[model samples]
Target: MLQPPGALPIRVLVVEDNRDICDNIAAYLEKHNFILDFAYDGISAMHLAVTHAFDVIVLDLTLPGMDGLHFCQKLRTEAKLQTPLLMLTARDTLDDKIKGFEVGADDYLVKPFALQELHVRLHALFKRSNGKAENVLTVGDLTLNKSTLQVHRSGQRIDITPTCMKLLQRLMEVSPSVVTRDTLETLLWADEQPDGDALRSHMYKLRQAIDRSFEQPLIHTVHRIGYRIAEDM
Candidate 1:
């Protein structure tokens, strides 16, 4: 499905062998509300990559089992998955970057990197995946224009925050499927999933902005599960 920009918080698989670095990345990402999954070796990375869907992957060059280059090749050649890859390596050379790209890496970051830069790079990777622009979104009088992040109901435009827009977009895209609270929080917060009642508060705000003003409520609570947007509602 074509998820709107920021519709889901970027899911990142951190494939690094260094325990310290892996923990650091996980901590940083969690602080940002990203649902971070980890793999310390190339084989495991490949397995996770193939089995689960990720918005972007942060791969290390020196991984156990298969190396990053080989893993990238396998992903492109064998798996045929085009998920964006951000390569991380201690080998900061022109040839290294070139080789990574030659395989299938969408972007590269040399080790001893800044946390901020990694964040920016991940953002860039996913934005590029979506052609880096907001256009229009349709989900059964409910229409959204991504460029402006605006929603419409039967031609009536409604103003919404970027967060609400994202929530609605995801719900609409996966209509009828229960979106778990964790999943929705992961999509909205990214590495920064909230604790306590914060997520519930956001959902309330989103419902108020979109569904409260309309008839035939599109957003529905799934009872002990999460939430879903019903086009038929």
Candidate 2:
């Protein structure tokens, strides 16, 4: 199978109850330069899938506690995650596969499949998910190129610090949606957090860089809630 197009590793979440299957897939995919995260059951998988971003999700249909169908439904509807999901199941019936797609599975793979086939399918799914957009993130005229780390607004190039860029990327990724202060803090510092409004200080620097010169002011504070990148829709 071909490696995903990029210098960064392809992040994959494999949600399978079968230990043997998980090990087998991990051994092969890891050799082929793919980063994999595993969850034995659906409940923990749901938490991982919602909280973390992955290039593709390889999910088995029969899972304990939550089951793949319900997990997929909640991931799509409740979490609003558009990550590509591929279902692995022994059920070969058309109805079973249809149910998988109806619940927002991007592709289906039957059990006892070859490891090579799974790799190929996953690469394809990742390509399809990232098609056309080509690693460029945009909120209004502000564009941040993932590959280049370049930011531009209103046809003018804007210089952004790496720290500010991280904050900008998160806000733009979920544009128009309030991203809580807690969430941003977790993303920025993880467990070894800085004390006393360090996040607010960085946010202030970011705002001055991205919004001070622009008239339309895209970044908005939600007033005790968090921040968002939007143009007042």
Candidate 3:
């Protein structure tokens, strides 16, 4: 990973066993002003995905150790990583494409494809990823921007921790609707159940950060229920 000046550049990991193809891709993309990293097998690709942050990954389906489908599954199910994946495979059948999609590949390209087409597909994938509606909720004089993972309020931005963001997102989603304690915990922790007071501690911090600054507190605790974010006092 080449660390350049200014904001982080979009990183790409190309996983292909063919040295010629890997060299060609690295050379071509480097010319187009992109940071490229190479991994020869699915195991190495999985390691790179887990260790480093990447904007996109060009994965080959038939790889030693773990195969592309299994790798994609691990990234989504185990790592919970959402980096866009462009699958490269010789299996050009409709079934192959369907299976790739089912395994979380953002795009697929058969072998004997042009480098230009690959570039275009990667460009489209990046555009789609950035163009998606990531942020979904906002309250009175408050804004929750998911892209930057930030929360702003009253023309001034308020810093929200990651845990609070999760809690706040749920609160904002069912705005005006009461979020029960059980529901809140399920939404925040999900599968892993924390201590009984864990939710309370997080909620208190979120409310303090969001509501304490403003006169009209937007976060309302509903008795035995949970919480709600409302513009109306």
Model 3: residue 68 alpha-carbon error in angstroms: 0.5
| TM-score of decoy 2 | 0.77
How close is every model to the real structure, measured as TM-score?
0.55, 0.77, 0.58
- Backbone clashes in model 1: 10
C-alpha lDDT (0 to 100) for residue 15 of candidate 3: 89
Clash count for each candidate, listed in order shown: 10, 0, 0
The per-prediction CA RMSD against the true structure, in angstroms, equals 10.7, 3.4, 8.0
Worst 10 residues of 2 by lDDT: 1-10
**Which of the two, 1 or 2, has more TM-score?**
2
Residue-level lDDT for 169 in candidate 2: 83
**On residues 131-231, what C-alpha lDDT tens digit does candidate 3 reach at each position?**
77366467778888756767888878788788898888767755766667766675566557875699999999999999897888899988887778898
**How many backbone clashes can be found in candidate 3?**
0
Evaluate model 1: give its lDDT: 0.79
